[model samples]
Target: MVDQSAPLPSVCDLAIWEPVLRLTPEDGTERGAGRSARVAGRISPSGYSIAHRGSMPSTARIAVQDIQRELARGGVREVVFRAEVRPDGLTTLGLVWPSPAVEPAYGSVNLGVLVLADGSLPAPWLRRPDPVPGAVPAPSADPELLERTLRERLPDAVGATEEEIAAAEARLGVTLSDELRVLYRVAGGDWADDVETAIRVDKAVGCEIFGVEHLFGIDAASRFPGWDLGATDAIRTPPDAVVQGLAGSPGWIGFGTNGGDVFAVDLTPGPRGHFGQIVLLGHTESLGAEPVADSLTDFVLGRLREERPDRRGAELPAVAGVGTGRLASVQAAAHPALEVLSLDGGDGPPFHLAPVAGLPRLRTLTAMPGALADPLEVAGLTALEFLALGVQEWRVLLDAGAVPRTLKAAAVTVRHQDHLPVVPVANEILALWDRPRIAQTLLEGDLGPAAAPA
Candidate 1:
């Protein structure tokens, strides 16, 4: 039998670690010859760190995804990993299997909302495609011109059959726009691999066009707006706005990418938008798509351009932050349309929720430790559905039975404390909803001191 003591390949593999210890920002503390890392963050070469995140660089991320799936197949809901390096050159690693709540610490792709017994989704995820009862295609929508232009560009390319095109539409449960229908009829994307497909599409169509079989509706699920971030998103489609600021829309037919973003055809127009306008959905950002051109015709005719529309003074802001460099206080962030408000407890004074008390749309509040003047002040934000606070604040609420019953999810935020202690608090919050508790099993192992660098 093979030696079972060897480490199982997982995200916890220290060999795959990035310079995270390098990116952690300095905290006026120093590690002597070997005192271990003084602080934590995404370590960088500058003796500081970036945000805590999973692996990037594609390769590492894919490996993490594969391992997570394997773990899930084995009935693991979540895995929380911890690595401690001591001044004596001893490193200890711990793995918490089947964590009760979906831990977001590192190498996690499960960004969905906390489980609710009724399976209710956050407000942002509840959006459906708005009806454009009498909307017509934008004036620039010229299917004939688009087809002629594409056919001219790819004379030798193969076109998708009428039956094939219909099959794709049927699978997506929506009819394709005339220009898009014509575009595919001329030449449906054909490539053996994603890399070659991207290369071919970039050269043939000025961007990466998904194959006929790859077409999909850019709905909320595609973005995976987990509760942590989704709860804070607000829908703001002003009467004059061109693109509705929504989590997603059924009318949005996603057909291509700019490598890191998506391009879609809008079937559900905003109050001022035209049907069949071309829009871009940035993969890195949350919610909403931005208009790139008036129509698919314009998009292919050298009118292709991506300019971020000015949302400032154009619509009501949806998310706000209050802290030392952010809004002066809760009063400054108050608005009838506000949805997510985050308070940072940097070096600034504490904040009072009095200014934002009773705001109808407020649903998610994330207050760092010491950020709130009074932990009980949160009781007044009656509309809150997801609240994240420091352990002490949660303790106060847990003790007073003052936790907002409206909360569908809650989290205990901590900076320097080990996660083992936080599990109980998270379980306490989950108990309020009669939801499943976060369960942690500690498995520890030690690796002798690090080897000297060559």
Candidate 2:
């Protein structure tokens, strides 16, 4: 008889593993799986490895294909044929498996292999997906796959109805954004059952879908008001280098004064677009005239999505609250093809207005109604490329010494109702005004270099 311990044949083996779960099955009392059994610690690149223990079944060859598809849903990267084995009085067996990367684990683990020699491991006990090191013995040539990874695993919240979502899209004159679309479909208007669970999965283990808010068109500031969602926070708009850390956590996503104002949205839900829920705290009054989305939480998300890229050319969201403390406090950050910002204005706690260094390619800014008022300020926006402010707000900035050191171009017009001096100031500085459409005047020359009177 062929020795059964010869490592089996190369392409016909099946391997299984079960990751240790922190909690024991207490007679199905727990609502969800408890914490992972794997402890937390530094894991060496080569600390653990896995290999198959036996051969696969002959009749189950076709059945194995179905398993591959299901595993993909869980974000398994690759799968391939592993080995073949001949049980002593039993027929030879064949097995196939995936070549998943060995990630760090904190606790004890178990691996199993099935040999189908008339008396092999029984069904249901043959294989299971678990957190195991080097288990399943990766298949040699598995192709890569695309899957949505959830960053946070909070329980699912209530989803929007098809009709409700459609109305929102029409009212906004834009789509619901990609991620929101997915949530709408998956949630089917009822997702509270798995909202919290989903969040935990994202925060703890590596899952197929990550709840990154950055991926979607929605801005973190509007989606989650109250926290310093401005340039200070990381997840919504982290720098180029810190992007990876923002993608995962113990890091958080929010915008407010004390930090209790937390908000999180899933970025992957709207793959073809973008979508997720937004939580608000302390500043329910922050959301503007637009109606709230589904719930107050979702309302924030809907508004954020509206500001993102639309199907038509790269359209920009109208900036609301420009010159006032409202516009001054609106957080701004750089995105790949565009920028993400929140126009919600309020008495915010101190926060950063720009990245550590600065954003170089900012092109345009629009003002929403009531965005800019008498006390407007725009003195610090030196790197801005294009400036568009409500005409009335522009005068406020002019009155408050709102000066652009090097403005390449500008488009300022107070809204219809109010009227201010067409030309507020006159100085050599006025000559520096890039264009002359509204109030054109020549500066009176530098007055003793004291910045031309306040």
Candidate 3:
């Protein structure tokens, strides 16, 4: 019998070992039983905890049994078990398997076996770093100078009154971070050009900050009716899969848009929720609400200093000002190593695809639906591996063999007013792929993959 009076061992005290499935002759005889499955474990203050990743109830039970048998075989004794009911009503069993070989040291004992009982695992398991507390930004050397510089650099800079700021907070249901509130009081919300650009904080991760009009509660009036502000849908990721953040959340309050992309702040506070932190709700090829910055101040300052055009190579100047005219002048001075590029023409004008012919190392290109109308222009991009184009352009590219043979994947966006026949176009694209490929099509509101031909 175990001593119930003694405190439980901490996870750090144990030599955490992954649970590997071991199949004996008897286990092998069981239908659907295969070689051992490896379940990763994390260290907590109490003990090491292992959670089933999307395993079915039946499968989870088997895994737990396998782990217990393996431990017993290893000479662990006096194992205790407990079942925990999750909020969703699923029962997850927790085990306390002790290792007698390893003696206790530093007031900590060996935590041989432990399992997560109730709550979901922390988001850090997805490899997202914990939010580092950021210091308040001071753009210039002097505080007064920083204010003056901000006013001069940011066109249409206006300060909000204390009463106005308070009102906005009350309506939003979350207190704005002090640094962000100061920004609103100093420079107001909108910028002059209103050019939407992503502030890259991590690789393939960025935050798209919109113009001033979307700031504060300005967009609430213009928000789409389908946009739900209270939905807290957890992201569906495979157990062992690593991603940025959750996908759907009612806690996300939209503040701006980057083209069709929505940028919002997570108001819900907890392990998964970055309460008061700015998050980029997935809008394009990527999915999930990726936490961009610790606060609005971090995002704005990071955008101004780090994501500036000058910092990024001049090979792609079109990113600085995203317009059809700006894109036309973006010529690669040499055989540039530009891999990913997104061209947004907005409502201004259509982008000229002539400059892209110079990029020999271009891999992925995401542009306005109408930008790739002329398939011949992009056919010469032999290095192009992935392309995001409209359904009409997919037809044109397929018919003309304009899609590079090097292209391994593609995504087509179907517009609301698009009346073009999709079945034939989808068929043609599928026929062109000789090997295994990934082909996705964005229909009306769904950004899922279109079924491939058998």
Q: Estimate each model's TM-score.
A: 0.71, 0.21, 0.27
| Overall local distance difference test of candidate 2 | 0.28
Q: Report the CA-based lDDT of candidate 1 relative to the real structure.
A: 0.66
Which stretches of model 3 miss by more than 4 angstroms? 1-321, 324-328, 332-335, 417-420, 435-454
Give the best candidate by lDDT: 1
Give the higher-lDDT candidate: 2 or 3. 3
Local accuracy by lDDT, each model: 0.66, 0.28, 0.40
Model 1 stretches with alpha carbons more than 4 Å out: 1-100, 106-121, 189-204, 233-235, 310-316, 345-349, 415-421, 440-454
Model 2 lDDT at residue 229: 17
For model 2, the superposed segments whose C-alpha errors exceed 4 Å read 1-357, 368-377, 391-402, 420-430, 434-454
RMSD of 2: 33.3
What tens digits encode model 1's per-residue C-alpha lDDT throughout 1-454? 1122323334355444333222222321223334454222221112212233443345534444565565555544444444455544344443444433453433222222344445456677767767788778888889988888887877766767899899998998888889889878886856655565446545666677888988888767667556666666666777787887677777788888878999999988788788898888888766777888889889888686566666434223468888867777788889988888999959778888998888888988988778889989888898887888887888899999998888776667765534335656776777877776654433333334444433
